[model samples]
Target: MMKLDICQSEVGTGLPSYSWDWWTENEANQFPQELEPSTWVKLSEVPSSFSFEEALLLCQCSPDSWLAWIPDHGEAVLHRSQFS
Candidate 1:
């Protein structure tokens, strides 16, 4: 059970557009099917055993998307350029 804050880039400011926490339960059903459970981890909960590559795959994001880490903040997956 970790608090996963979903952050989206705002006007290239690298700020979070929206945030949410993850707690295994009915919440998973509420999210889009493409989002993998392991795609996120709170900034403080990032495990030492985890790797960026692993997160990328688990994210199951589109080819045009990219993941970025904002220290002390959280990890984010940038989707289409227009929305970012």
Candidate 2:
């Protein structure tokens, strides 16, 4: 399995952002050949140490980072951050 480091922007809930750096070609190359093309790696296909509830909390509370895998996406990471 491929490993990725997830990082969250320091910006708070007003506009929270998370980045999966491993999705890039340069970063993917650091891993096995299988991950050369990130499109082949679905977000849902990977395992994550976090839960839905935890993700929800992270969205609500930005400036937090989690080393988690990308979830399967139809087009792109569609998760949005919204403050209550």
Candidate 3:
């Protein structure tokens, strides 16, 4: 299984922006090779301008199980069993 850290952020005004950042190549390389690219679209709500909420939701819907890394808050791992 591949492990990825998901971070969501909102920017701009009016429509509420959203943005997402996947780990660097070096970081992603640490995961298992068999695992496919992780998806990030189920943790939170969608954003009008690609806000952080959209990223969180994407992470939740990721194909490969992922562990979320929240600054100062620790981590959150997604499990198929939980949602299914």
Q: Which is the leading candidate under TM-score?
A: 1
TM-score for model 3?
0.22
Candidate 1 to truth, TM: 0.24
Worst 10-residue lDDT window for candidate 1 reads: 49-58
lDDT of 2 by residue, 1-84 (tens): 999998996655563345545357775456442212222232332233332211111121123222232333112232222110
In the predicted model 2, the residue pairs found to clash are: 43-70, 43-71, 43-72, 44-71, 44-72
The collision pairs in model 1 are none
Model 1 Cα lDDT, one tens digit per residue, 1-84? 999998774665654434344445575456454444344433333334332222322343566564655444346665533121
For model 2, the stretches where C-alpha displacement exceeds 4 angstroms are 1-15, 33-84
The candidate that wins on lDDT is 1
Report the C-alpha lDDT of model 3 over 1-84, residue by residue, as the tens digit: 999998664544356334445555676556344333343333342223222342221244355565554322344565543221
lDDT of 3: 0.40
Comparing 1 with 2 on TM-score, the higher-scoring candidate is 1
